[model samples]
Target: MAISAKLVKELREKTGAGMMDCKKALEACDGDIEASFDWLREKGIAKSAKKADRIAAEGLSAFAINGNVAAMVEVNSETDFVAKNAEFVALVNTVCEAVAANNPADLEAAKAIEVDGKTLETTIAEASGKIGEKLSLRRIKTFTKDDNEVFGAYSHMGGKMVSIVKLADATEEKAKDIAMHVAAINPKYISQDEIPQAEKDREDAVQTEIMANDPKLANKPEKVLEGIKRGKLNKVFSEWCLLDQEFIKTPKETVAKYLGNSKVLEIARFQVGEGIEKKEENFAEEVAAQMKQ
Candidate 1:
């Protein structure tokens, strides 16, 4: 029997299990919602489902390297303590290894990759059930370098943040320094050339508006005003572009000067719990509510 997406969503809402798990349960039970709900319980996935609503903003950012290929992953847990758990750390390493080995294009494809005869999604669900928290694999990315290019990886604060950089015509030490710089500076683009025309135009407009409203610039010639706008735009790009930013180790020199002839091919950085909105609870209010219950 063919299972409908509506039925799968309905079952997921009722059980709180992963979408793939819910779909499998529905298929196993001939699209019967009640039966699928029971099926998930029997499989012990519903145990983790109970924690699905909890915020999982704390976890580790880790990476794995295999020869010329490397992968990075961020996995979230409900608390920092759980994020440091041996089992949780192992799971993150496993995820990173799987990503590097399979080189999946996206999160969905990465989840479908098999490990120990089980889908990555099922493995995560089982781990979540055992870990007693809402565990989620937030994102994964893979990078590859040519023989002449070198890859550098750095983990800051025991995986609270991680960065990887690929550099062409560079030594491993230089690459590692670049990666560390990337982890600290968090540049948006490798160079000014990578900035989109639209973004440059937007910044140009902003600078023009600021100068137009300035009394000091009102008497300035149009050509001078244009030069000022261009200079302002370049200053903004220098802050956002990696090569223009001052090097962390040597503030006297920009990253571009530090690199000399080497070129940064790619860079990736991940910080745990960067964008997730964490839950804040009032202890007294919670206690009162529990007492009322």
Candidate 2:
């Protein structure tokens, strides 16, 4: 089938791929727009892989949860302005909702999940192609399905950082509090046990170095090391442990005390843009580029 220029333009608009690429895809798929879209996605993923090493620190973290399922998705853009674009936000919502409903097992599975009568993989390809940027999905996480569990989500400053918490016997108010706390403090884990053993060992090593250099500890025997280690562990625990951190709502109370007898099993997860190096453009550069255009 012959691909028309207008058709190619439409495809280009829909998938920010180059006109030639869109045209070739349309021709390859015999003018079936949807099939052509899948072709673009397969190609986009290939392209994205090459660019994966770049640092992506800017984008939006989106969350969606239904009665029994929940998901958080991080979709990155080149600029903060683009992150706030209504089209981009809508795309994020669509992707997150698709993840919650379908509960795809991984990023690839979620991308394969269908949305708006099209697979997410193709939809993203179409968006990246249209947006004229390296738009990509950085991470996706879905909570374990439990009918009795309640999920909470908090997004700070337009999704720069986001926190998702899964809970047991959570009241609406408690859930909201947990979400708010996670957003503000950005705890590394729900508890000490959740912190990796390697990370703990590193912290211990740093603490030992500090203790050895202390003037007051010059003649202290190894027995003093235990006390110093305990102090260091307590300090680290208060900083990264969700249960140890002061409650955002009360501050006077720990998170564990906030729940009282409520069976609150908190699982907190967060993701910042993993691998897209943000392009930094200054005012002069912006104006120069505009003037040239």
Number of the top candidate by lDDT? 1
Alpha-carbon deviation at 244 in model 2, angstroms: 0.8
lDDT of 1 by residue, 159-207 (tens): 9999999999999999999999999999999998999999988888888
The global C-alpha lDDT for each of the candidates, from Candidate 1 onward, is 0.91, 0.76
For each candidate, C-alpha RMSD in Å? 2.9, 6.5
Structural similarity to truth (TM-score) of each candidate: 0.88, 0.76
Scored against the true structure, residue 4 in model 1 reaches a CA lDDT of: 84
- Model 1 quality (TM-score): 0.88
Model 1 alpha-carbon drift over 4 Å, by segment: 1-14, 19-39, 284-293
What candidate 2 gets wrong by more than 4 Å, as runs, is 1-56, 274-293
How does residue 126 of candidate 2 score in lDDT? Answer: 64
